[model samples]
Target: MDRYLNHHLKISGVSQQLFADAAVTAIQQGSGGLLRRANHLARGALIAAAHEKNQIVSAEHVRIASTELI
Candidate 1:
């Protein structure tokens, strides 16, 4: 999961990690271990973080994205 996150974020221009550990766990659980779902949630979390002007994505941001998507 960590490697997956790292590769995607790196290509997305995130030199440093954007997600907190708790957020990563939340995303994993929410994604149900599916790469496509994980990608969706991660993208949503990034948008949520950007909207809030947050430097890092938190579990709250993931929750917010989950709610908005579902």
Candidate 2:
């Protein structure tokens, strides 16, 4: 999972440790489905990053995206 998270973090440009850790935990603990939620979060983060014109995906973006999924 660490390898997966690291790869996504690099691709997502998420430099914040807190956001990265939260993302990892979200995927690890996803209730309905792990892979599905991970993909959702990753895709959402990428969208959020693009929308915000941010090089790094932020915790706020993750939070927003997760809430949208919920």
Top TM-score prediction, candidate number: 1
Clashing pairs in 1: none
> All models: lDDT?
0.90, 0.63
- Write down the TM-score for model 1: 0.92
lDDT of 1 by residue, 1-70 (tens): 7689999978878799888999999999999999988988988998999999999999999999898775
Residues 1-69, model 2: lDDT tens digits: 446666766777865443456555554555245766767876687588679887655556666677778
**Stretches of candidate 1 exceeding 4 Å from the true structure:** none
Model 1 lDDT on a 0 to 1 scale = 0.90
| Candidate number with greatest lDDT | 1
